[model samples]
Target: MPKGVYLRRAGRFAWLAFAGALLATPVYAQKRTATPQKAVQQQPAALTIPSDPDDAFVALREAARKNDADRAAAISATLVDYPIPSYVEYFRIKSQMFDSSGQPLIDTPDAEISAFLQRYQGEAIADRMRNDWLLVLGKKRDWANFDVQYPQFVLKDDTQVECYALLSRALKGQNVAADARAMLVDPRYYGDGCVDLISYMAQSQQIQRGDVAFQARQALEQNYTTLAGKIAAALPDARVDGDSLATVVKMARNDPSQAAAYMGTISGNLSRDEQGAAWGVIGQFAAKKLMPEAAGYYRRQMDLGGNQWLSDESQEWRVRAALRQGDWKQVRQSIESMRPELRAKDPAWTYWYARALKADGRGSDAQQQFQSIAGQFNFYGQLASEELGNRITIPTRTTVSDAEAMAMRSRAGFTRAKKFYDLNLRFEGNREWNWELRGMNDRDLLAAAEYARKIELLDRTVNTSDRTKAEHDFTQRFPMPYRDIMQRATDDVGLDMAWAYGLIRQESRFIMNARSSAGAHGLMQVMPATAKYVARKIGMTDFSPSMMGDPNINIMLGTNYMSMVLTDLDSSWTLASAGYNAGPGRPKAWRTSLSRPVEGAIFAETIPFTETRNYVKNVLSNATYYAALMSGRPQSLKDRLGMVAPSAVTTTSLP
Candidate 1:
């Protein structure tokens, strides 16, 4: 095609494609044309500007993301009549406020930001802008204005903001040490807020010296050497050496035993808390490596300085090490030592603690623990239910009246969210939608999910329905779109349809054109290399990576690949699910490391990679629920997992 003709066709195609997405039953039901098109296509006949307002809006957003204030303003000027004007205005204003790295541009007046917030009050974008401005105000130490705006910032999800908020409180002579310790668990997001908080807290003597050492341990564990050094400098005695901390972190990565040995040599010169922190780091690395000595290292840490200085994450690692070593006593003790609130937050810890109780012959106590988590719908929840002799079943489906569903169509948030979704701006769309879901009752959630389904926002439909506490619509939550295509694909490969659906639900939430950060694409999140490999295996001579965007082609290739992994892993769902996620080699190597047959749940929990461990558990749990929904029979997650035995002969390679 000629350049002029191609551009016109692309512009028209982009609008028509978005239009089809709005009206289609499932957004991906409409197939794309063979050729790829640019998001912001311009027709030659329309001078240098984009032919469509939405295309110009897309360009404005790209400019804003780059913090190109001039370009954003120029493009946004052409989008005066754009369908989503709030976002267009938001980008124009935001571009002027922050540089490309998201640092606030110096001398940007706070009045301009407050004006936007005042105009768009109670909207998601306004709340988001408040979050941005609070960071700026916090950095500038403009606590007077920050104090006024902090409570109005609705989401409060940003950790750095929380840090700054705590810092502001501490400045007012309030004790915020406990709050800082709780919120500063993750150093990756510490930024200026957390780093400043720690410094101020230490200088004021509000937090104990042990707290500073713990912060250093957390930073070193995350490989934040500079942050760790800063934390060490906050200690009054300067007893914890920054260079020694760096050496221990490096040694832990390569060899946990070496890290332990180095810690042992330095133990006498260090404070008890520092000694414990060093030992905790070694234990965490060793636990991740599945080393049997991990439990002993944790015990040594506890023996030296008690568990008072250990972070919640370090305490969790202590439990994991015990679970790996099958040391029930250590598991029980470590869990009991955790802060009550932290221990109760994660059901995985509860489940393991219950298992330890049962292993220690405290059956009634274990039963009580199991009952606490049993009727829930997550991975640990299902496992707890099976332990209580119950199978997973679909909750009774809830109904939404037509009037109730119709009401969502008039909601301002939903309307804006739909507009963003139509423009393919999912981040903004999700924020708008989720912000509306706060404090909603079960019936309201069901109605909102119904509205989502009617609008072909199937992912939103699933997520919205999944939030209901007392009522549910299983059909809405586990939406089966393109059933005929999915059915045929699974049948052709002799794959279990429910299992395929389960994996797809976890993989992409049925978003047909979904693409992961690692470059996995389509409904199945098939990697490009894996798609080609499956294409060849299944005799798809004309297959290309672009073809993977098709729901039919993607599902077929994904299910075929699923079948291959299952066959390679001896048809174990647990192993195959892990293999599908982390790769065949990892699960294979994990299985070989097992000394004897263990329950599949143990194998999943013991998996070293956090992503793969959670993926396997969720895939199996989803498969159980999908099976129950399809078969109209209570399904056993335990039976589905079965036993994962040691296998010396395991596949080490696959696409």
Candidate 2:
């Protein structure tokens, strides 16, 4: 979700409010039959219908949003000459696609949906209709129809849809266990479709009991007790039951030592995988708590059964625990013990593994690992560059010609995407935009990014430009909008303008009225309380949270807060960036918990909160690129990161 999407949604709701009076007396506004008055009014005339087609369409849009099929039908009936007949028809069709519970209406004919898909074949809504229909088909076990339509789902980003697709293939005697395993890591997204896939695969012997057990561990780790119970029931063996697994997982979460003891009591009755999984769970919780015993638990986990039973998460936590203890050998061993696919997927492991190699006098091997990831542009990639004795610099800019950019403006997909963006339907707009970029060459991508910038969609500009392989455009990727306002704010507090802009880019993608779900507002994503606190600190007694919507005010308050956080955290940009995202209290506590001085990358890796970890990495990496752009010189990400040392005393004075 975009930061400040709620603020944008508020604007969308304003349109809904405009038609609220008509909606108040909706044609289907009758209450339950238990109310005598409602029963009498059930057959009332359509007196509330608007004469204007636009107003009628808006009413229909609102009805569709509420999933009021009867009202939508009543309103859409009056939009006979609506300019956007596609949308008018779409709202009507969508209202009937699913019932109030969001399940596909079994009575809705597939022919009607197929007709809509054929009518608006390449449009975003048509694809959305197909997605809705596919779910209905999947639920009904109509794999024949699902197979015919699944290829047309343009985004294919929905996990449930992917699960269904995999399930469809599995029903046809195809081996999809590996693919299903990869997709089923996050139990939170495992709807009935994924659950069905796992159950079927388990029953048919396509997937071993270990696979189901692994999923059960994953479910328990996420506190999805019911899901864990369901998955555990799929295990063929009686020893691996839900109640026993949940008890150990719950114990591990609170006290790893207790869980370790509990595991010892049952070791004789459990399989090797079961024992390793329990130890892995204990180690994960212990490591996250920064417990000193975490390393030993991880060691025991490995000793029990090595990497085969360890989840990717467990292996990563093992590396984290080893890093915290400064055990280079353990770090190397833990990383090397990771599944080959997992090791290759994350560069953090590769970078740390390289460091471990260097620490052990394996210089040539370490150099190879660093060289493999150095050319990429990311947190680890930049660190690897520095390890290889190279400074971070911008790749040569790839210019998109005016003619190429203009050509993109005329493309149907781009136009439709722009329309959706204008309507604040960002999800649809982004899908529409990306759908057209699949086969584009590097030059074409640059052109689309430039066109995205022209449309003032800075987020799209950054994301699209970031996709290029052979060509690059830093300006588009790291745009500096509201430069004068941001510069003035930064200068007022002796702050780094590049760093402030980088934070804003990450915070809001330069969206002026961006708002986060946490109630942060504007380009800075400054929370209401933080804005007020900054307002008082700056002696702006008259300030209100609404002022955060203004770029100037948001930047002023945000920069001041950033400055305060930096000062409180000993002027360390790494700590300050972390403080900015997760609040000052967390980084302060994290620093105070450290046993010794650690490299900035290691400190970032060990951050307990996943969001803040990634946030700090991206913000600093962004700052490096911004610094390069502003200074017209090579910049060092390592210099920005510095070294994070333990603090004997910590304070949470900054909010």
Candidate 3:
């Protein structure tokens, strides 16, 4: 969310008027004339200096507010004489004076801003400065100046690849292209820029047909070698040739399968040091399930330099391989050699580690670990808790019964009957009644139809425009079956129905068997382990992994897991939501560290994860609409959700 700037008009006027009234009133006629006269006789008429910087700042702010340029300038000059950084003061002066209409002011000229930015070229603030400079450049049409500053601004390691493409388009000259190509090939751009450059080229149609294969081959070559080297170097007690190994590791990650294949071709070419690195690559690839062939390579690396890092990597792969093969002993030995840091960071590792400990007859230790993680209000936490015999309890709403819900659905119809009826009555032949209806998506339409239908059933007159919109929305993409499934899941888990819909929309677009690149499966994108636990808890025996793809099974398990998370998070829906998106433990950690009130917007804005932040918003917004529609309220989605200021509307309650 963006910050708001408010001008205290009444306060400013009151102070100014009070000062004027005081001057206009005669001292002789005032009741305190004698005291004032005595004070005038006793005191010197010199100006008093304030002891605090805050006072000085306040005076400056007042002067600026009054548009007293001379006083403001004097204050600025005086402040500049002090040793403190004047950036804030400079910003304030610029913000106040540039626009009488209260719009934000950009004080520096395009060229000057670019020059100022160059001084802090590689600093952390460079990105912000560069963005501001770009805006200025665009506004002022300083293409020539922009072309010059572009390369310098992009030298910062953190510069986004998008910046390069923007620069390329802005500076499409032959000379600029050559320079950009040089930058692309530089070792400094090898990090994220390599893939970014490829993507940019692909989007811009800059890469010719012949260059595609060549570029892909080059990427394959560099990444595979770099990945292999990093693994080798990170191995225990192995003398890494150089930083080239780390580079390869990152490169290999970009295209794991290709990198794994490249390892075979480069095998004979690798020196003893290089060979160890190659084995490391194989281990990483196998860990990602990218290339199982890398297993042999990892073993070979272990054979060459049986050090801790290699041993650790080897063991990690062994665990994965064992899990795939269901070899319990290999899983145990592999997990044993794993570093404590890996075990702590990865929930899967912790779960498996506990499993290994349990299988080895260390039940007490295993139970403790499992208990600590179980009852966590997230997928993994819920799984852990379920395994420890903590059953999740879902809360129920008493307002709507199953019969009523079924009746509402029946009225809404499988097609557009409910929508058409609602709209026809809402409009009542009044064509002019309309609303902007901002943020009205398909789900909103469904809610609106539901809301309108309830109103019409009560014989209330609704605006024609709103009714038309509701009907149009409902008929366009009902998502009724999907909505029904989600509602059921939410009800079953005692989760927010709207939030469930939102999650489904985001994760799978209401597709029953959606699978993400990260291996999150089904409507709620439940992980395999989470699904497995949920199935077991529900007394589902002989549950195939493929069962997770079935909507009914997925929703049952996902909702049950959601209920577990809600329980573990102490019934705080906000934390539960966060736990749902980002594992339960992280939200718990975040809550402890940042302790802000868990209001939807505040909590969402403060979320460190961008993905999770947006996820929360979409879910909450979805929930608001769902509640209003399902509950038969004719309230705006934002109003019901407490989004718009309460004072914006006359009534507080949903209609």
* lDDT for model 2: 0.81
- Which candidate should be chosen as best, given TM-score against the real structure? 1
Report the lDDT tens digits of candidate 3 across residue range 455-487: 333111112112332233312121334567666
C-alpha local distance difference test of each model: 0.81, 0.81, 0.46
Clashes of each: 0, 3, 11
Deviation from native of the Cα of residue 583 in model 1, angstroms: 0.8
Where is model 3 poorest over a 10-residue stretch in terms of lDDT? 646-655
In model 2, where do residues sit more than 4 Å from their true spots?
Answer: 1-66, 78-87, 235-242
Point out where model 1 deviates above 4 Å. 1-51, 233-242
Structural similarity to truth (TM-score) of each candidate:
0.90, 0.88, 0.31
Query: Where is model 3 more than 4 Å wrong at Cα?
Result: 1-478, 482-490, 595-598, 634-655
Supply the global lDDT for candidate 3: 0.46
> Judged by lDDT against the true structure, how good is candidate 1?
0.81
